[model samples]
Target: MTLHQQTTRRQFLQGTAAATAGLLVPFASRSFAFQSPNERPVFATIGLRNQGWGITNKSFKFADFAAFADVDANVLGENLEKAAQRQGKKPDGYKDYRKILDRDDIDAVMIATPDHWHTKIAVEAMLAGKDVYCEKPLTLTIDEGKLIEETVDKTGRVFQVGTMQRTESGQRFLQAVALIKNGRIGKVKKVTCGINGMQASPVIPEVKTPEGLDYDFWLGPAPKVAYRALPEMREGYGGGVPLYSNCHYSFRNWHEYSGGKLTDWGAHHVDIACWAIGASDTGPSRVTPLDYTLPVEYKEGYPVVDDQYNAATQFNIQVDMPNDIEMIITSEGDNGILFEGTEGRFFVNRGKITGKPVEDLESNPLPGGAIEEVYGGPVSENHTANFIDAMNSRKQPISDVWSHNRMLEICHLSNIAMRLGRAVNWDPAKREIVGDSQANTFLSREYRKGFEIDM
Candidate 1:
């Protein structure tokens, strides 16, 4: 079937399923025939970088790539060829992501752009009638999270945040939450999340923008600034680019584009911590920056120096969670979460879960379908599979925006507390800072001219 015909067929099937069952059926249990290319959902990916390519690469089995968009032409071309080889069909490419949203044939979009660009693209995509699967730390500021949440509710779209631990990580996190709920760790008291720290960089000089890269578009919604980089190349998983540049993988080290490790790793571990403790629906009462070391000086919350990484290099914060539970977020010790309660405690990360309680699980064992109960259904093949399932059911996926934003508020407040060198009070009900007006100003940002969200 042609692309248009295939889209129509899928819509008819979806509507039929909803009508027959009085609700959309989950993708796994539904007896829909989707073995052919024409039956797969049409998808496009924006921001062809480390995570942009990662999510799209995993989604190939469930969706057909109709297009790809990126501000850097070189990166776009390279990923297009890679995608074609993998799927045996070349997709159209564009530097502007809006062109992809303009296509009616596209059913959904996977946004893995920089933290600064996430909110704009995601909100616009949903407005254009497309489901979204955006990477975590979903918003640059707390206000942006509210904007995306409002848009999702307004558009009735299937939105999924890319916190794959909810679906992947070998279901270890699921088991961890299940254990907590089953009283394996009775009356949880304190939870520590050691997300680790990033290295401080030497002063990076301003350099000419690289060829085939649109520097202005890359800085969308962020303050306009000179492109900066050093000649030294990073030598690991996210290498080839300058190790100290304020772009690419190094963007995580700057406050303009990302929230450093606080929002980076914190998005993952803190999210799981809140879920296990039954605080996913609520917010913290206070966030105090006990100790932290910023790479550069800061007069207010804004950084003083423009060259070096400004985000906290090493830090520790104390968060007052609901029920008087104390949560410690620090960049020390092993990179994982340690959950301590009245009865027992355990440590969990992407690799393993260890503790006396975990050891006893082999003999005592969780009740049948315990993990599924936490997950709300049978686990899918991967995170992307869960997104596709949500698309079919028209239901929110495992990592919904509400829970993600609630946990992310802790991380955002931590950075704010560290920047101001004081504790900040948070009224979860109002979703705003209590008394500190200056600190509350950091909750939202002014967008660069011409790049503001149309909403």
Candidate 2:
């Protein structure tokens, strides 16, 4: 089907790029030459509940949203209806994203699925000649990281990771990196990263999966298991006790689907950590998990879950870098980063950026090319716009797979160290754990039969 021909009830529901107030307009009118009448770069999105909406909403300016895919019919069903109303067309909806990937009319895909399905779907989509925008924490494992990094280069297709911090403005997170790169921060000595560690999955007993939800597809690549209301805090489940927390947000807490808070928040926080330290291509050389005392027993709805929190609840991990740079990652304290340079130290997070030596955020002028360079040239309206631009240009997006793989590898390493309770050595060149069989197990997992990630 052609881009225009693909329009259906479901496509209209997924949204359209037609000019409208309070929303983005078509990039074609802005001088983007990639989308001709026959090549509009029709796009589809997998996982349409939360961030998926943001991606879809932003992409309306650049691509035609011809399809929407989701496992839970109830949740995405609302999104489909909204997309149709906004776009004034119908879109194809599917439970299996692979169906969407296989469409010849689709030139690209925006993936916002749970973490576990990221690498698999992205790899398949790229192989199918579709550009992809997979969510952050790009890979669930170091091996998947390597696979994605390799696959993108091999496929020679546009692929953007959802590391939107690079697109955010007036934030010291990226500014600090530019400052350090410009030698404003002097010689960097160490980086102390503070991220909340992963917590345990809920202790609730299994319950029936919700209707209109394909439980098995939702558990794609992860082992099949019964559902208990996965905790859904305002944002996501932190993998803890159940209450109003019993919804669909907490996938980050488990090793199966996500990197827990370490990766969940780490994808954002550590990404800045790497950016500020000027180590986006390479990661720290070593990860040593520092142990701390925890509750011997914790209450979960009146019964003890017995250390249900598989990931480290409290610990400090030290990562050694080349040139004598050291990264100290602490799971507690504040949620941000501390960059210690030869001359001074600076602390930055979502709320604030402060240090003994760095200039005030408002006072310091950013380098002329800082914003454009970070976004690969003048910024697109936002992260999704960047992806659409890359989709039409057939160029790499701001948060391409290689950069995100390197950043996420650090998160996976932290989890591996916390779980193994030891420091693991890494060969950055090979992208593998050095001589540690036990730790290597964390690299990639054995898929349960049909769900396996293929070479």
**252-340 per-residue lDDT for model 2 (tens digits):** 55566775666877788778777766677887788777664232242321113421433445667788876688887777888888888
lDDT of each: 0.87, 0.69
RMSD per model, one decimal: 5.4, 6.8
For all predicted structures, in order, the TM-scores are 0.94, 0.83
True lDDT of residue 176, candidate 2: 63
Q: By summed lDDT, which 10 consecutive residues of candidate 2 come out lowest?
A: 22-31
Best by lDDT: 1
Give the per-residue lDDT of model 1 (tens digit) for 1-455.
23453353332122211111211112222223364557688899999888899999988877889999999999999999999999999999999999999998998899999999999999999998888999988999999999999999998988999998887776678878888999998999999999999889999999999899999999989988899999989897776688889888899988898899999999999999999999999999999999999999999888888989999999989999988899999999999999999999999888888898888876788786676688886666678877877887778999999999999999999999999999999999999999999999999999999998876
**Model 1, global lDDT:** 0.87
Backbone clash pairs in model 1 (N, Cα, C under 3 Å; residues 3+ apart or in different chains), count: 0
